[model samples]
Target: MKLHELPDELHDLVHYSLKGGSEDFPEMRQFLGVTVRGDANLIWNKYKKLAKHEDKTAWREWVAQRKDSTAARREADEKRELLETRRRQIEERLLEAGWEAADLKFKPWSDGIQQWHELVEMPKQPRPLTDRVWKNLYAKLKPLLETNREERIEREYIKRKIRRRDWLEGVLYKLKRTEPPPLLKVKPRQSNSETLSSVFRSVTKRDVFPFVHDALKLPLIQQMNEDDIGIEEFREGIKEHQSKVEDFITDWQDKTRVYLVNLIQEEDREYSEILQPPKNMDLDAFARLSDDQKLLLRADSLFYVDTACFRTLMVDQPYDYGTALQTAYPSLPEYQPYDLGTEPVYEPEAPDLTVIHRYATAQEVARDLLEDLGKPNASFVEVNQLHYSCQRCHDKSARDWTSMLEHYINHKQIQAKVDKHASLLAEEGIVYRNVHDRSFSNDRPMIKPARRSSALGARVPVKMCKLCERKPIDLNVTLSIPRLEKHLLEVHNVNDPKPEVHYSLTLASMFGPSPGSDYEIEEPDEDNEEVEADNAPEEVPVEYYWPESSELEDEGEEEWAESDLQ
Candidate 1:
């Protein structure tokens, strides 16, 4: 009979019988014309008894125990192989280092083993390797060791030192001496006459200048004869002779003053050198004040301005007779002037009144008032009135005009509506309000339609959200991933599979019961009621079950029989 035609009980028996002795079943073997060893029916009966009536639990326990034992044995074998490999590698390295097999001895301890060369004896007074020997060894061994090996060697040398304490102290001392000193704390000071004189003497000693001749040149002095001349001629002759004499005296005096001032300025170097101040004088101070102070002091003493003949229109006039005398002769230092108080008098500048007048102009007045109202553009009445005033009159002209205009505009209610819309937009992050200016309100508007451009030829429709039915004002939400994941799972009842959890779910599914179904919404917890509302799902019936041991055994028997046949 065909397998399917047999009764269920008989079929199960035949299946198990064939399965148990599949390799050695005589009936199956004869049917297939292959070699067979045992009865298939008998083998199947044994397995059937084991599955149903036999002590199955104990047999399972025995099988598990055998598997564990086999795994443990294999693991031990693998570990032994690894240890053997590592031992071989270590031995090879030692052998390469010139340790012969006979010379090497290993002593095993409780923790581990130590290897030593029996042929090599400890030296009592071991001498350090000569430079030549050390260099040769290093040249050969450096390629074999890592960069950190040099540091290890040095540390070993230090540790093996005969007088370690003294050696360390000497090294520290040498290091300290080699270090550079901290920067000097002193600031520069000004040079004086003594310093300048010393510098001059040094320069002279270097033979900087040599003059061939040392004679003075003189011009003849003449008196005009006015007695025999006409009235005009005589007057002209006197004037001409007086001018010549005055010019000569002025030129000579100016030259002499300049020479003396230079000499005094030169003496500053000598004075500075002799004093030996803590710091050098700044070059800027020397250039600006040094020559000026020296000249002033000299002129004060002689009661005259130096280089009086060279004076231009811009020069200040002599303050007193002392200044005038000093200008004529700089060398006479004994003639000192009366002291004036050192307090500086600063002349205040006159204020520009034009600024006030300019502000009163119609354009300026309007602009200023507009600015105060927080508006820059004069054409925009809303902004201008908030910030600025009337261009013509400040108080009288604009007060009524602005009030009437503002009243009319407010009556229109456009500003109020705009403000309300702007506030709404701000909540959505579409616009931001200016906190500083109360009148201007929010800078950005809610809906900014795309502008048509001829260059582009066509305009595209603006993108917007479907649920909120408004374009996302600011699409960027700053919630963290974990919080978002929790929101999706708790609010929507969707199970999102983590990399670690082998299940599939989407963010949208997690947020709700079914995809696009408003039927099964999850309610928010009592604690999260203040947060966004998560609607509850409609109620539905669900069933669960538990099977009896008899039913489980019968099912297991059937499965076992089928498996045996296969």
Candidate 2:
């Protein structure tokens, strides 16, 4: 082919060869079908020179871009290596300064410094003046240390805030792309007159504004231009609307609670806490207690009603209840508001285990799992290797906790049962089992590993795209499960990939060399005198023994027989 007409890969290969990619010009000539004898070397050299000039002239701009790309990659690698080296140096310095890893894990910096100073001075038995000097130095350094600590914390807080804001914006963008949650509505009271008017009115997004506002607390920025209101006046407008939203939510909650109270009273199912005061408490105290406090004492019933009411107010859709709950009470640390102070202690919200008259929805299943995990906001990654299977479905297939929630929601039969409130009639059984447990059927499908933050030292599991296996591509490109899904979407034009159908897990090797292989203790060769001598018993070295106490009288019974042992 003509040099200009050559395929891009071949042209690039020739260019690479000219750029010192290969040493053998004769081999290049043979590869390019320029094989002959005699003047082939001179011809090849001339061809290479001409090719170099042509390639450079023709693709000068592209060559520069390639050079820039290569430079960027080189710079990134160097930067990463530098960062790694710096981390190692810091660790070494910490060790040398007698600081434990835990000392620096959570710190004000002064604590570690103090601990290190103590470690250094404790064995010295220093003079009083020297001790005072060290103390003075610490006193002078303390303010600077505290200042540095505050600055560090502030930087981290700002970083966290930026990350959370970006994440929220991304989520909001995604939410905009998907279908909006079902609007919550309530039927109005019927009229006594003959006019049969419809009571149903679709609730606007404004009705669920309070919970969303409380949950996300997204920033409100004014539009650039307005006829009457300036940017400064927007805050006042928002405050007025906010007050109205809060009042609406409070009124709705009060009416809902009254309905719940009446229902519980009719059923005679209210706990003692809800019914009467304790024997130790006076009637005045009982009367003074708020209804919420009283209900909180019997939290199970309250939680059940709370969850149901939240769902009713938020989405009014069975499948979307869990998503609404997640938005309202985000469990992930990143999703949480950045706290400048020490982490606020949270009382674990126990699951409402009191079986309702309905089959569990995705919301309830997720809540139960969260309560069990003792981190109501945690993701499926926390419960590593565990998968949930529905006994009611009678399918051996398992799913990760998040996917399990989705399964329950999407199951038509389960949704029907849930709608009819007849799940309690059946067992409503779901069990979580470890995927790695051999006792379970080997033929059972694997659950996708949860995606985790790319923290240093995190061991991400590998997954191979099953789609790639069927395609004309390299089969060895194993990625993390999340990355595999992304790869399928980007490269294979596949969306909504199933873990079992679209991907296969590549678990890390657990089996090492057998016990009797390289690690086995070998039998000694007694036949060789040299081997016998090598295996002969030896006395404990004198250096290894503790020094004799100065108080003990020195005995001359032991003779010095030191020789060159080194």
Candidate 3:
């Protein structure tokens, strides 16, 4: 095939061959007509002999070189195989001894075959030493010391223990060998010479006093020496002074009593018998008198009297009972009784006479009086004219009389009834007719027309339904049934049959029955049942079909058979 048309794998192989100097082969270059460059010599050498014919000598030389190359490759392969075998053996030994591959240390052989031999002889892994073995090793390698013997010995022991397992013991031993710090010495305390010198200097001052006598200049001290008195002597002096004051007070009291008695006697002579002094009076009897009597006796002793004598001295011709009682008994000190006078004597206020009176005229008053008497329909103009004409003949009394007469004439019950009737007539827009008798004419109101009733009567019509021939009936009733059925059929397409109607009954009964009643069943006719049976459909059952081999062959050969037959 052409290069472009070759399959992808074949195309790739051809392209590689051409680029790798396949075109440089003499046969290939000569056939393809391509030139080879010098750098293609390696490819040429590799493919040249394979592509070209060769002599026996050349074959022999090639075979010998090939044999030597094969031998060198075989030796390298054997050494690699040996190294792999040794690695596997080491891995196996470590695994059996419960050690990891990393625990084995295999040093590479760097010298010649002798070095390789020595490395092979060397152990692939060292055996782990036990605690006892380590201890023995530490003991053998431990150091011995002499100068500063304890510290040196401890250092040596630590080094050995670090290699063994006595870390705590080694630390303790080191601490034991360590020396303690030297103790500090205490010094003696010094005296305060400066304080002693200051105290001595103060004591030797020239101006300092040896003693003080403050008591020598005091008045209390002079008194104490003159009397040689202590607290008892001071208390005696206070008692003597208090006794002299008591005696002087007693003498002054006696002089005041005597002078009061003499002055009272002189006042008694001036007042006559009404002021005579009482005989044989004691302090208790004086105290028992009223306060007025006591004051009169103390200031004017002539007014004092014995209680029994004073009572007997009042005996004489029968005294005025009121005046004698007033004189003998004390008045109640003439206290004025509290005067809450009648309503505090307030002045009654006068009515306001200046207020303008909104008084009606004589005629107007008459009209108002008539209206008040329920004759509001009376003529005011006629009433006023009567009053004015009557006033021209007489005084205001005549005018008042005329107005009063008019008021009385209009105030009849018959007139009031007539007025009320007129008002009602005006309200209703009714005409009034005069009923005239011999002496009088009265208004007689005509009756008003009656209003229409608003009550909703029955919806029953005065006509009959033309289609159903239902009569003595309402038109609305006829419409309701057909209208309801039409709405059900046209709007909801309900296929229910029309309800039966009885004209003799009310319309309510005709529409009252429910639609779901099975007892009201609509029976089908014989013709309808026959028609339904004629339109009934047939039924068929489903079946599964499988083709036999013969049938399949027959179907397959049918096309051939048809061809042959034609």
Q: What lDDT does the true structure give each of the candidates?
A: 0.28, 0.36, 0.28
1-566 in candidate 3: lDDT tens per residue? Answer: 23333333222122222223342363442233222244234333533464365556664555456456645654555455555655465446435746433223221211122432333333243223445643543343222111123332333332222211122122222222221110111111111121232232111001101010211222442353345333234324324444442343344334433443343344343321222222232334334443322322221121121223345632121111111222233221111111111122111221121221211122233333333333332222111112111111111121222334332232232234445656653554333221111112123211111111223333422211231231211122232343434433432244463333222222333454332211111111111110000111222222221112212221113211111100
Rank candidates, lDDT, best first.
2, 1, 3
Clashing pairs in 2: 331-377
lDDT, candidate 2, 206-314, per-residue tens: 1112233232332332121122232124324434555553455465445544543443344444333342332233455346545643442221221122454455442
Q: After superposing candidate 1, which stretches have Cα over 4 Å from the reference?
A: 1-62, 85-93, 96-566
TM-scores for every predicted model: 0.14, 0.20, 0.14
Which tens-of-lDDT digit does each residue in 206-315 have in candidate 1? Answer: 00110100001112211222122222342344345555534544454354445434433443423211111112423332234333233422211112143535456222
Which runs in model 3 stand beyond 4 Å of their true positions?
A: 1-44, 50-56, 99-103, 106-566
Least accurate 10 contiguous residues by lDDT in model 3: 203-212
For residue 524, what is the lDDT in candidate 2?
Answer: 18
- Highest TM-score scorer: 2
lDDT of the structure predicted as candidate 2: 0.36
Error of 2 at 21 (Å): 55
